[model samples]
Each structure stands twice: as C-alpha cells, then as structure tokens.
Target: MHTPSHDWITTPLTAALLRGALDVERTAHGLLPHRLPARARAQFHDPQLAMAESQPSGVRLAFRTRATAIELDTLPTKRVYAGVPPRPDGVYDLVVDGRPAGSGSVAGGNTLTIDMTVGGAELTPGPVGTLRFAGLPDAEKDVEIWLPHDETTELVALRTDAPVEPAPDPGRPVWLHHGSSISHGSFAATPTTTWPALAASRGGVELINLGFGGSALLDPFTARALRDTPADLISVKIGINLVNADVMRLRAFTPAVHGFLDTIREGHPTAPLLVVSPLLCPIHEDTPGPSAPDFSRIAEGELRFKATGDPAERAAGKLTLTVIRDELARIVEQRRADDPHLHHLDGLALYGEQDAAELPLPDGLHPDAATHRRIGERFAALAFGEAGAFAQRN
Candidate 1:
C-alpha cells in the first residue's frame, strides 16, 4: 500500500480510459476489465472461459498526460498449480509515445491454487499492490499501462504527479482477433510482447483480442460477441484448442467453423476476414488428442503436454491439426466463391517445421517468448504488408 501523498493527483478509473476490453465490471474492490461483455459471459458457465476472459490479455489503460511519475493500484489474482513451483509474477508494461518505456509487477495481491489432477481450486485473498514508473519525460504524450496477460487484475486507483485525460483516438483501423492459448499469450513474457499485440503494433492498428486460454472452442456466444464488435480487420486462428480438447469430430468441426464465420459475417460482411489454422505441433500433426499432462518432469519444476489419442483414430473422423487445416482451407475456398473479402492462412506459415526444429515449443504446446516474436513478425508481414489480406487500400 502506498501512503497518501499531498502532491499526487487521483484520477477516477473509467471505461473511456481503457482499451481492448469489451466490458468494465464494477467489483467490490474496484473496476475489472473483461474481454467478453456481460451478455456474452452470461451464456457460458465454464470456469476456464471465465478465468481466461478476465485475464486482460490485450487490455490496457490509455491516456494523455505530462506526468513524470505514475502509480497504479491493482488487485491481481495469481494462479498456482498444486505440484509445480509458483510461476513468476505477471508483468505490467508501460508504453510512452507508442514505445516501451518501463516494466514492473505488483508485489502482492490474491492467490488461487489449483489441483489440475482433481480440477479443483482454492482462492486466498491478499492485499492490493502498486506499480510505479518514475523519471518519465515531462512532455505531453500518450501513455499506456498494459495489464498482465495471464493474471486477472482489478484497477483500484490511478495516481500521477500531473493531470491526465483520455487519449484521443489514433484513427487507426481496428483489428479484432480471436484464437487459442498461443494467441492468449500463454508463454509470453509480457502483455505488449504477445504475438497479437506485436502484430497489431506493426500493422498500425488498434487491437481487440478475444484469445481465451483453453476456452477458444468456437462457441456461438463468442461468435456473436465478435459479430457485435466494431472492427475493420478481423482474424480467427482455430484448431489447437479444438484438437487438444477433443471436443468435436471432423463432422462437427467443419460445420462449427462455417457457423462461426457465418455469425461474424452478420456484423462485418465486408471486413477483411482471415481464417488461420493451427501451427506446427508435431505431437498432434497427425495424431488426435485429448492431450494429457506430462508430469514426468514435475520434480524439475517443468510440465509438458502430450497427445493421448492414436493416429489411427483419424480413420474414425478424429480431428488433428493436419485434418483441421485441410478442412479449414476447403471451407474458406468454398466460401470465397460468394465472399470476396474472406481469406485463409495456414498456421504453418507463421511457424512451420523448420521453426519447430529451431525453437521447439517449450511445453510441447505453447510457444516461448522468442517464438512469439517470430510469429508476430511473420503475421504482420503476411496480414498487414503490401498485397496481404488486410493491406490498407489506397
């Protein structure tokens, strides 16, 4: 807790000062940013979805200020698995004039312990913590405090030496993207370094990310939420979560993909819509899943994942990354006959066989920080560069 200072000016945390969040929920302690609106959240009861949506993967506090010193009070919910050592505290990245200025993390907040084997969790309350950045240039500039990508944080207070106001819109095209854990910044080191966030920066676009951790199952409610959102460019990266969860077979997967796209078109019929398939996961490239945790290295404080289903199951309509990609390509090709703005990108183009050989997925699932940068760079080139699907029209 920070002591009250006479020189500090307190600002009310309002929705207008936030970006990339679909809703601002009033909590007992403060305001919580949610990626899914209340109505869309009401349609699902899954705890994974709830947790992922509240984690604020791409959400940030934005404003214009001349403050040389700034402090933000937040209540962050940190997660711990039962057997593994506690993960590092989530990072808060500060950006000034669209460039990285500094980074910090709250010291303490709340704790949530989870037993993955039993699917149970225990919550422990903790005190709010403050993140401070000082010695900034005292010139007028746009500032943004990016929340942690993996921790649920509630904004309790905003304090600065100088007054602040909501930043004016930059007038960039808005890019709304939906994907799975990789897109959700699973193994990303910081909020601003996430692949989607990096890509958005390079593309010169505003980002509204709906990449839920383990909850990107292409739910109808999610589709509707995407539909209702206003954006100029849209993309959906599919397959990883579906394959790992084993939620649907080939028969169900194809129609679900089509339906998800159909819903988005209802709101953005002319927007550039790009459909991306899964990246190269050798374990699930041909084999089906029901991925299982590989706890063999748990004693070493390392956890890995493996595909549990057999490759032969593909004959029975089992879904795999390769299968999903083929089907997605076919679906996009067929739909393009009627929809000229629709496009398809094979996820391998972002991270292919050569990439897996060089920078293998640390957990046999999500990419590491280096891979995130590579993917982000590749995506920006393919989606926003000249002649790309989302290339700005003259």
Candidate 2:
C-alpha cells in the first residue's frame, strides 16, 4: 500500500469536493455520501434503501490538479450471496478532462452475506483498503474519481502527489432522476457506465441519481426528497418496483403516482418534468408480482426470479407493467394540460420488445451492460435531442 509522505498533500472530503450526493455523513470510519437527505432518511428506513443510498452510484470526487498519482482510502461494504460465486470487487473509475483515464479496485472490505432462500442478511466487519491511480499526464486538468456504484463506500482519506482544488463548474444543467434498480445500474460494468450516468454524459448535464433497488415504490419521503433537490431537468421512472414488490394495487397506485408528481411539482412546477413508465420485463409484463427468486439454478451458480402473482389477480387491482404504463400515460396526459412543461415518455421507446429480443435481459430483469449503453444512447437522443422534451430552447 502507498503511504502518504511529506511530499504528498492530503485533501478533506467535503461537499465542495463531491457531486451527485444530497448529504455527506460523518461516520466513525469516514465520510459517507448519501443520495437522500438526512430528513428523508429519518422518515422511513429499509435495508435496501440504506444500502442503495450509501452506494454512491453517480457520486464522484471532482478537482483540478497536475498530480500524476492519486490515492483514495475507502471502507467498502461488499455484498456476498451464500452458495454462489463471489462477485468481483467494485470498480473505481477515473476520468480526466472528461475522458476515461484509468480504473482500479480495493481488495478487501466489510461483507454483507445474504441468504436468498430465507431472505436474511448478516454483516461481517472488515478493514479499510486503498485505491491507487498513477501515471497521469502531469498537466493541470480536471479530475473525477467515480466511486463504486454497487458498494457502500465510505471516504476515509484522499491524497495526491500534488495539491488539488475544487474543479470549476462546467455550467451544465443538473438532472435529478428517480427510478428502480435498472436505473440504479444493477448489471452495469462500472459506475460511469450506469445508464443514468451515461445519459448524463451524453446530455451534457450533471446527474443526481436516486435509483434505489426494490425501493422506488412511490414513497412520499422520496417525493419530498426530489422536491427539495435542485434540478433543471427531472424524471421519475415508475412501475417495476411497485409491481415486483407487490406494494400497491391499481386503486392505490394511480393516486400514489399523482401524489408523487404533485409533490415534485410543488418544488419544480415547470422544470421539464418527464414521467417515464417501466421498461420491458416479460416476467412481469402481464402477470402481477410479488416476484420471488428461483433457487433451482442456484447449484449451477445462477439465480433467477419469477412473478408469483397470478395474471387474473389484476382484475382485483393487482398492478403489472402493462397496467402501470397505461396509467402513467393517462396521468401525464391529464396533468399536461395544466402543466405545459410536463411530458411523458413510454419506457418502451428506450427498451422495448424489439430491443429486448436483440439483447435480452440476462437475469430476466435488469439490463446488461450493453443494454445499459444502448438505453443511455437512446435516452440521450429521445429526451435530450433537438426535438426532445428536455431540449434547450433558444
């Protein structure tokens, strides 16, 4: 491990040095970036939300320096599943002057062991580790170190060969997005490659991603968090979580969706708000969920999910992707008359049946890395293009 010496300069990991995070928590070990504010966190708490918010999906350290070597000390909480192959270490991506520079990972950290069969988790504490990146151009330029999207990483320390100052703002519009796991980059190869991150890059905007795995169920606290956040362009991708978790019926979902949008409009009434429906997931397309893991392939090191609710249950108000999409479209249409800036985008346009046929969802849910890239590219063209809803008007 590289140790900080007299020649090295250490910088404090403060809010000014971070982006895409709503709050910075001072932990026993280090500073933890949270996607949701402290007040929102206080209202409701879940293990899934806690883990998701702490992962720092789109969060990055931003600075300008001539340093050729950089070292970051982090204590990452890695997730492990019993009786399955170990997942690779979360990746730390380095971007210099707005371009991919290098990548690395920490070897050891705390582990959260999860047993899918019983729906239980156990945390085993581990030691802090270091991530090192060296051999840069040695010229003054913008630097960004994107944290691991899937790991709960606490920033312990930052050191570099040369001094670093907060990078000058590029003056891009800030985009705040809320959605489910796919939006959270579940199968993405790296933090930067996450669909939202990629879309932000292509759209020339700053991103604050609030995509929680299995937690985007139209919670009021989350709506308030979005309302409180500062954003120029905003989008809410709904449906999958509500369906798969079987949290709400159609009777409850419509009002919840309306209320969610209403709360956001309270803060950003005219900020080109886009309402997006669910992407194509055949398992839950027509069938209602409460999805459950299929452990049959567990011995082969594969885990898949199946919808548990019957399709006939929809008659009694059980929600599904098909029903949710139609409701979302109707809701947006109903509100757009009074709110000119409000618009709707069918998730199918981004990743529909045709695209799914070409690049099927690997685990039957989240999009793969290539699919993420395709979605990002398609989103950029659809939502940020010249004729798109979020296009900059002259």
Candidate 3:
C-alpha cells in the first residue's frame, strides 16, 4: 500500500511513548514487552510470572500522523484455556485525536493453550499478521493503538499513508498504578476498557499501568521498579493476590507491606500514593488459599476458582481476604500520621457483596466486562471525582 504524498516509513517503536510496559526486549522477530525488567525477570522463572508479565496489559503505541490509512504488523501470542469457552481474539483499539475512531485485531498468531486441571500448557506457533485502518481525516493528529491487554504481542512493523512521529505529551499528570490480575484486566472487555484504563480515561491522566496478573505479590523488585518509574501520582492495590496465592503468612505480610511502601516513598515522598485493599471475593474472604479450580465445572464445560485452605487456619496466622484488608487499613492509617500524602481505599468500596450479587463474577474470581465498567465508573467518581483524592491535583 503506497500513497503519492508519502512512502512507507516504519518508525522504530522505542520506549519514549510506550507507556505501560516496563521494558521491551529485541526478539528474533521483533520486540517483546516485558512488564518486569531483565534483572527482575532473571530472578524468577515461574511460568505464572512469565505468562502474567508477557500479557502486555495496558501496552499501546502512541504517535502523531497525517496518514488517513495505517497498518500495524504484529505477532501475538494468544492464550487458550481448555474446557472453558474459547477466548475471543484480542482487540486493538485505535484512538484518533483522543477519541475512539476504530478497532482492529490481528488474524493469526501463536496459541498457548492451558489445561488448568493438569497444570499443563502447550503453545502452537502461528505467523505474523497486519491490522490496517483507513478513512482518517487526513490532517495532522494524535493516533493511538492500544494493544490487547490479555495477549502478548510482538511488533513486526508499522506503516502508514503519511509519515509518523511520536505524539507530543498531552501534559496530563501520569498515574502509575500497580495491582493484581483484576487491575491487569482479568475480564475486561477490551484493552482500553479495562477498569484502570477506563478510570484513567475519565480522570484525564496519562497512565503508566504496572498491573501484573497474579504477580503483584509485593516483591522487593516490583517495589524498586515503582521507585524508579517517574510519575506525579501513584497507587498500589494490594491484598487480593496475597490471599489468592496464599504465599505468605501475616507475620511476613505486615512488614512486607511496610517495606513496599517504604521503598516507593524513597523516590516519591510526596506523590499521592493510595493503597487499595482487595475487593469482595466471597470464597477467599474467610477461607485461606491457594485457590484451586473446581473441576466439577469442567465436566459441564465451565470452570471456576474455589478456596482450598481451611478457614480454621486463620487462627494460626494464615492470611485470608478479610484479614488482609484489615491489615492494609491498619498499615495505611499508621503510616499516614507522618506521610500525609498516603491514603487507603477499601477495595470493597469498588466491588462489594451487593455489587457481586448484582453483577456476579462468572469465574468465582474475576469480574466480568459489565462489572469492570461499574468499577471503573465508581472509581473515577471516587478517586478522580471533584472531592476525590486525585481530583485536586488533576
């Protein structure tokens, strides 16, 4: 595809405007978005870490162009969960001049199918594909293509009818957020519609999302990454991952929380730092984890998570969702006495028992698309609204 005014000029996708991913690696074919830097990634080889970090949640290409037609070539690694409904193709959202203009999806890509029952995964390789968009206004304007939050994508090339360049910073304050899978867009409908994405949109903030799936376990490395990242506003949503993964007992958790915040404050002592607790997860509220799948549903062509740890274990210092929330609240209250910018938001305020009853979580874990929308809207109103914490700054 060629235009008289311009020959194809493929700009090297550098880190200048690639907001979400922490690091990009040169792959054999193209570039791979790694949520964690090489130093951190080298420390852990867990498949869960690999899968979550590679999803590229909140990743996108942002630039300016006069092109009426644009083509993006990418090699995506799509995930398929066996026995559950086939996940839809990951969506790429195109925003022209700050408003949604169109959307596209790559046709073919590699497939990673996971059988949770047996804890096995297999990848079937596929080839690169292109997403072409035309019929633009044909004037200089900002253009953004948000990559699918659920799929890992490798950029092959980008072409356009007109020359492309980095989009100018819009001067919005950057919001750097870190949380668990729910924040990583577990069941959000599209890349831009993820709860955090939606909230960022409504709040009019530049987003640098650090939302890793099950990987938000308050690790020192993640804290260091947050410390190093530049931002005007920062938020850390904790608790859910700790409960679900059941990785630490209360003895380790309390101080871990302090250390995480301590490290972040090292770099951003005055930035508005909001610590969010877990939302309502009934199964894990009183019961401890690590959560396991209910295989009974697979027989019916469905799958859901169930808490496996005994509730009685809580007396022995086992962490549950309930216990985690109280601890987080206490920690934030104690710290805010000296750190005035620090704050806490009960995750239940985002999604409570009533909200769950109305918009039930399909997997007994992650919220569905509708729930995502509700939470996004509420969060925008609470955290970004006129009387909200981010309101005055923005």
Candidate 4:
C-alpha cells in the first residue's frame, strides 16, 4: 500500500554481519534441540501437573528468507488451553534468518500476530495484519522461533522463510532463589521474566527458581530441593506463606528454619545463601491467620476457605516473621565463626520502607509486575551487585 524507499534493501555486508554464525531449525513442539542440547529434555523431565492436565496443545513451524524484511502471515492452532486457569503469555524471542533480529508475544484467540521488538506480545493478523520488516539486509537465511511447552496450546503454522538456527548461548550466571507464591511467580507476567528471572537477567546468572507457590514451608522436602539444585548464588524468601498458612508457632518456626538451613548447608556448605523475609503484606503482616473458615464470607458469596492452621497454636509466638528473622540472625551469628559462607538479607531491602510506602500490594497479597520489576532492580543492586558477597570468588 506504500511505496518502498530506494534504500529499503540493505547492503549484503550488513546482511552477512547480521547473520553471523548462522544456526537455526524448527519442530512441531519441543525444545530447540540444536541450541539446548544439554537441556533437550528439560521441559519433559519437570512435567508440572498444571501443564499435564491441560487440553488441546500443539506447536507450529515458521521461517523467513530476508534478514530484515519479514512478515507473519498466519499461525497453526489458536483454540487451545481454554480450560487452564492461568493463561500462558510471554514475548517470543525470534531468531531471524539465523540471527537475533527480535522477538514477539502471541495475541488474539484465533488469529495471531508477531511484533519485531524484544518482549513484545504476539499480534493477531487482520486484512492488514501481515507484518513487514523493511531495511532488511537482502540475504537468504533460516529463521526459527522457540517456545517452552509444545503440547496443550494452539500453535498453528509458523510464518517465516529463513532456516532454523541453534539457540543463542544466553550466558546466564547462576542464581538460587527460594520463596512462596510471590517468589514462585504467582502473579508475574510470565515464566522467564519473573522477579527472580528478571533479577537473574540483570545480574547475569542462571536461575534455579525454588519459588514454589504455597509450597515453601519449613519442610525438609524444601531443604532437600535446595540441597539438590546447583547454584552459584542462593536466596530464600521466607515468612508470608508460613504466616498466612499459620503452619507453626515461634518455637517450631525457629528451629524449623535452622534445621532447614542445616540440611541445605550439608549440601551447599559454602555457597552464599541469603535469607529474605516476607515482603510487606497487609493481611498476614500482623493479623493472626484464622484457624477456622470465615463462614460469614461464604454466606455472603465470598467463597469461605478452610483455615490452614490452628490460630491458638500460633498464639504462643510460635509463628511470626519477627521471631523467624530474629532466630535466623541469631543462628547465622552463632554459626558465622564456623560457617563464614552463610549470609542473611532482610526482605525489606527488596520491598521495604520506601518501596512499601510507594508501592503497595494490589490484592492485599502479592506484588504486581511493576513491583516485581522494582524488587528485581533493587535485588540486582544489593544481593547480586558488584559489592555483593555472592560476587566474591570463593
């Protein structure tokens, strides 16, 4: 519909430079084997119950010919993952003609769209939905797009003429993170860029996200999970879950955290471990979690929920962050002489004082993506910054 500029066609040298070290490919649904050979079966191995229980999922193939000039014509499947509770969404990082031109996120229910920008969501195609990338260095190159899960989603035919290339070495550093739902990315936008993921990207570390939503109790299983995962830097965001779940009293909470650390130290004796308390949450900050269902809510259509723990049991200072954090500090202080590697970082650093004053929880619960970004930025500056002990060579 518009006239092309005389300089629309890029120079061949430009194309060659953009297509440096070409390697690309496409599969119906699976990890990019060529790029992630080491983690070829990672998605399959984890097999989250949430993903397994979903219905009608599939993937598609798309390629592009020109380095810069590209368009998204159509997609494979769209009517998928309909029943799943939390919908999947993220920007697809695109490898155009063997080089990283940009990526896009999928959008719309039936039709699909592609954005030529980093962290951009997929767009749906209309009569004018066909996207065109100008100023393309004229060259024949393979293009490949990657997604996490293959099955249980709508992925129609991929659009591209370029050949698939190998995965780009992300060169991520190592970050070990632990926490409850908030840390587990309960309300974050996507999987890769959760607060931990965002922090890792900023800090340049590989992330072992041990942020299990509603699962990070002071349980031995959790310590075992931490003990097992490989980590260069470690962090445990504790408190909120235990407080809300009302799982223990002060006495039990104290020893449980110590015991948890004891078990983790058995494996990562020297790894720098940061113990982060819960961020500022109102519902459970000071109020004792109800041990019995608030039947009044159910009667009023509020969907009453059963109490997770006994309130009377926690009345004896048996369950509280103040107590937990104090005990943690004491434990670390006591062991610092023998275990110089252990470290403690308060959660407030990430979302304390000024942050809580400015940015409050939306649902009286978890922080939104903006808060996640704020926390990630601060964490990168504090826990993983150049001055961070984790940055020190052990």
Candidate 5:
C-alpha cells in the first residue's frame, strides 16, 4: 500500500526537513465518523461499531504533504460497553504506509497486546509503542490505519521525519459550524459526505465541524468555539438536539440563543451567519420531544433510553422544535435590520415535505444517507451557490 513520489523519491531531505514539521492529527473516530471496512461484519449508529468474529472497522489517515518522511504513532486504548457484565472488546487493524504492519487486540483473558507478526514481538500496553514506516515514496502520501471494535482509542501522536505541507490553504473562506450529531454525520456513510463537509466541498470552502454529538446546547462553550475559530461563513444548526435531549425550557431557550448568536457576531461581524432549524423529525414534528419511551426492545433488546420532555409539559411551552424554529425566525428578523448579513434557512428546505416524502428517515428521527445527499445538494444551491447572497457579503 506504499507508493513513494515517482521521480521525487530519489531527492535527499532538504532545508524543509531542518525546519520544524507540522503534524496533522486524527480528526474523526471510526464509528463517530461513520467509517467502516467492507469486511466489517455489522455496524450501527451507536458509538462503537460492533463486528462479529474477526470483522473490523477501518480508519484512514490522509494529509496533503510535501514532506520527505512521515511516521505514525498510536497508543492502545479500549472501549467499555456498559452491558450486564461490562463487555470490553478491544481490537484494531494497524495499517501504515498502505501495508498491514501489525495488529493490536485484547487477548481472551482481557490482556492487551501489540503483536508484530514479522518480529514475533507481543508488547503489552505500558510504554507508548511506535510503528514507523520510513522513506515514504513521495512528497505527499496518506498513511491509513484501521481499527476494529475497540474502546476509547487515543491517537497518541504523529511525527514527520521531513516537513509537512503548509496547513490547508486558509485563503478559502472557511465555514465554521456547530450543530447536533446529525451535522456530525450520525448515519451518513463517509466523513466527506456529512452535510457540513459536503456543503463546504460544493461551496469551495474550508470547514471546521464543531458538531459534537449531543452537545449543541445553546451553550457558551460552543458559541465561544465558533467565535474563536476564523470563518467567512458561519452556521448553527440548532433545535433537534435540544428537543431530543430535553435540555432547555422555552423561557430560557430564547435568551440563550440570542446570547449564542451575539457571541459569534462579536467575532464575525460581517460574515454571513446562517441559522438553520431542525429538519423534520416525525416523532418530534407533531409531538414535542423529550420522548419518554423505553424503545430498547424495538431495537432488538438494546438498552431502553428515555429522552427528555413530557408532552404535557410542552403544553406549558417548555421546549418544542416548532417553538425553536419560530423563535429563530423571529431572532433573525429582529437582527436583520441591524445585521444585514445574518440569515436563516428553515431545515425543511433541506429535508422538508418533498424531500422527506421522497426520502423518509429510516427511524422517525435521523435521515438516511440518500436524504443527507439531497440535503447537501439543496444547501449548496440555496445557501452557498454563486448567486447565494452570502458569497456577496463582506
């Protein structure tokens, strides 16, 4: 799986090597990023990708490089499933320089191991281990590694023998977004296909996805995260998660949103900041969320979970997607006079009536991959197209 740069492979390390190298750290995790290998037997949206027998999930490391040498370093980590007996299965496929260099796993007795087949060395987890593939063929090569059903794995570090490419050209108007797990690519297949990534690719912009799973709570941390990040276009997909998690009351939600938007505006004064409401979730569409049912058996004896909110409570307008969407529209309208570039896009436009009817969400909640693609296409056209007014904004 290794291909050095054709003619450039013969060149010696130059001044770039003497200069400090830039490390491109791992971005998304296996299940989190929804990446799995073809051989991976079974997969699900839960945090871990469960595989039967020897099947495993795959992880790829890709970085644009102009460096002569590159190395990958990882530490053994395990995931603990909180089942009856606390099942812990830790196994990973280590691929470096495009070849299967080694395999790491938790032995039958739950003993951790790093087994290098060629050297017959079985090292346990104590000191950090290094798997180095030297003399990479070219100035740029992707070092991919795959991991199976493993618990919380930490990519310890990445080191380069030669200099790396300058950080992805920042000249492109970067779009920084913070949203729910859906934006984080819940069921979507690939990293690049996530709504945000897809929109960025189509819009020809750089993207920094701050879409933490179950974490976009009109919180100051998220607003500050966006405020600190540099971006030409900004968007916050709010509502679905708030209603799902049953986090805030309507009274508190409004001001919290205003504060969140205010914080972002401080950093990006004139940038077009699009506020997107939740896509239609049938269950939450009619019935306000904080869905309280033990849906475990429905998913095959899986653990039953209770979402926040009592429909009766929402009678008091505690928290509802409808309420959120209405208020978001109001918020943008109020600000439009003062802040001309601020805009709002209803989630329905992305996956509204027509799209929903065509691509019904598998569950009553999240849209499938096809729906995601449709959403991306529509978003690119409406929100970021050549005629998209955001492009004209300062």
Candidate 6:
C-alpha cells in the first residue's frame, strides 16, 4: 500500500538484528514476537500467556548502518482496558551508537479490548502502520529500534537508504530477567525505558526479557524457556503476581519456587542468579488478593484497584506481599549455602515505603515511570555495581 523512495534496500528480518525475543512466527503479512518459544507457547493456551509473550516487552531491532533514513512497517495490537483512558499509541525508540537519537509512534493498528469487570476480551485487527526516522549522521553506526513494550507488535518490513548489517557484538554479558506485569512494563515510557532495560543499560549487558505481564506465575514451561536461553546473569522477580493472582497457597508456593529455581539451574548452574521478591504494593501488603477493580472512579476514566482478600487470611496460609518477601528471603538464604551463585534482593530495596511516600503508586498497584527509573537505577547499583552481585571480576 506504499511506495519506497530512492533505492531503499530491504533486508530480511533475521535474528541478527532482533534481540530479547525468544521466537518469531512467520505470518502472512509479517513476523509476530513471542517471549516463549514455539514449543513452550504450544504447551499452553492461557490468554494471559498469549498476551504477555506477544507484547514484545523487551524486543528491539538492532543493526549497523550508514543510512540517514529508515522505515519500519509493523502491525501493533494496542490494548484498551475498560474503565480507563484509552492507552496511547506505542512508541518506538531510536538509539544510535548507544545514544538515544529519536522516537517515532505508530498511529493505527490492531486493537484488543478488555473488560476487567466481566473478564472478557476481543481483538479487532487493523492495517499495518509505518514508523520512519531520518536525519542520521550518515556514518557507520549501531542503530536500534526498540519496539513497544505493552503492545503486541508484528514487524513487517524494514527499509533503509543504505546497506545494513548485523551490529558487532560488544562482548557484553547477556542479562536475562523475568518477572510479572511490572517487569513486563505496565507504565514504562517506552520499550527501552522499562526498569529492566534501564538496569541492563547501566549494567552494560545485553538483555533478554521474559517479563510476562500477568502471566509470570512461575510456570514450569516458562522456567524451561529461561533454562534454555543463554545468559551470564539472571534475575527472577517473584511474589507480586502470585499474591495478586491468588493462585497458590504456602504449600504450593514453596515447592513451585524450588522447582522453578531447580529447572533454571539445570542450564545455568553457575550463572549469578538473583531472586527478587515483590515491591511494596499497599493494597496487598498485609492483605491478600484477587485484587478487585475499584469501579467508583471508573466513570471518570480513572482505574483504581483495591485488595479484596482478608488480612487475617495470612494466618491461614494466604499469600501477601509481606509473606512472599519473607519466604523468598528465607528460601534464597537456605539455598545459597549449596548454591554460592544465588542471592536475594528484597523488592523493598528497589521501591520501599519511604520512596513510596514521594513516588506513590499512581494506581495503588503499579509504579509510575518515575518509580520505574528509581528501581532501575537502584537495581543497577545493587546488582551491577563494583561490589554488586553481577560485578565484573577483573
């Protein structure tokens, strides 16, 4: 439906330029991103899994080129959660030679409508949209186009004025991280602006993110997917989704964590692994959940959430942020004796009460972009600083 100007060379979209995604599905019009490889994706049809994996949370297109102009055609599935303002179009970030160069947004694409009250959803497909960038330095340089973190983006065509080739690896350690919706980038400004992405940037490592929005429930298949991926460093942010989802009790949670870690160790036995507990979510602090949506302000286009479970339920093995944090700390400590590479990072260390007083969770659940930045900076210092867990030995 469009015409190319002046001898634009189109290169096949291959793994060389794409990072963070586990697999790509060849579609009639383009390629769909998948956090879970095809084998794992085929193991489950959970809608949460489908949405999370396809969102392309940390996926980006990177290459070395001399082109002053570039264009990318993609089909983005934008989500509109009921009772809230329509989410804005996803932003694609342009980074040149490690510096942010420019940004572009795709206007029209697919739309996925979600009704939290009834827990129903439907997708309406739209046409492919184009993202264009120009005014480059016209010198051989590394370029990256970070895809939208929240929207499901299917990359279609890539056109540039000059020849493009795979960017040379900088020989940086690859950091693989997994967590819940927060890590999946609920309110991050852009794909590369996610907390993990920020941390990875500060840490100076390649990133492979498996942060599945509501689907980071410590599933075995996800563990296997992480196990198979190559990583020099690993971190797993646990507890929030488990507590919020109200999926398992203490009995089930303990064994599940053990099994998840056990599976990951199978492939990355000696890799430095950090176990992260949930951040301070006020609603689920002492209270357990199945967090209920607050409809009182929904009419005003404000979406708020409140804990629905009882505080006293903790005595009955009901999970809460406090309970999960304590358990995760204890689990990591006990395991560290046998697994020297294992470490524990309390979520509070990333976003504790004092910080919350200043940068409160806007929705009473997810952190705003500012908090994400703080967490990322703190994490970078904690895990990648000289005395940090992932610090360079030399």
Best by lDDT: 1
Give me candidate 5's TM-score against the actual structure: 0.65
Give the per-residue lDDT digits (tens) of candidate 5, residues 273-332. 999988877667645666544545543523333445556777686777777888899988
Q: Write the per-residue lDDT of candidate 1 for residues 1-394, one digit (tens) a residue.
A: 7875999999999999999999999999899999999998898788899999999999999999999999999999999998898999999999999999999999789999988778899999999999999999989999999999999999999999999999999898999999999999989999999999999999999999999998889899999999999999999999999989999999999889999999999999999999999999989999999998998898898889999999999999999999999999999999999999999999999999999999999999999999999999999999998978999631
TM-score, model 3 to reference: 0.96
TM-score of each model, paired residue for residue: 0.99, 0.98, 0.96, 0.60, 0.65, 0.98
At residue 321, what lDDT does model 4 achieve? 54
Backbone clashes in model 1, listed as residue pairs: none
- Candidate 1, position 353, lDDT: 98
**To one decimal, what is the Cα RMSD in angstroms of model 4 from the true structure?**
10.5
Candidate 5 weakest ten by summed lDDT: 15-24
For model 4, how does the per-residue alpha-carbon lDDT over 245-334 read when each residue is reduced to its tens digit? 676777677778789888888888888987877776644545555323333443343322233443455456756555566666777788
Can you tell me which runs of candidate 3 are displaced by over 4 Å? 1-7
Error of 2 at 33 (Å): 0.5
Q: Report the CA-based lDDT of candidate 1 relative to the real structure.
A: 0.95
Candidate 4's displacement at residue 329, Å, is 2.3
Clashes of 1: 0
Query: Of models 2 and 3, which has the larger lDDT?
Result: 2
Q: List the RMSD of every prediction in angstroms.
A: 1.0, 1.1, 1.9, 10.5, 11.1, 1.2
Candidate 6: residue 32 lDDT (0-100):
85
Q: How many residue pairs clash in each candidate?
A: 0, 0, 0, 40, 6, 0
Tens digits of per-residue lDDT for model 2, 1-394:
4578998899988889999899999999889999999998888768888988888899999999999999999999999999888988999999999999999999778999999889899999998899999899989999999999999999999999999999999788999999999988899999999999999999999989999988898999999999999899999999999988899898999899999999999999889999999999999999999989988899999888898999999899999999999999999999888998988999999999999899998778889999999999999889999978789621
Candidate 3 residue lDDT tens string, 12-41: 767764767889998887888878888888
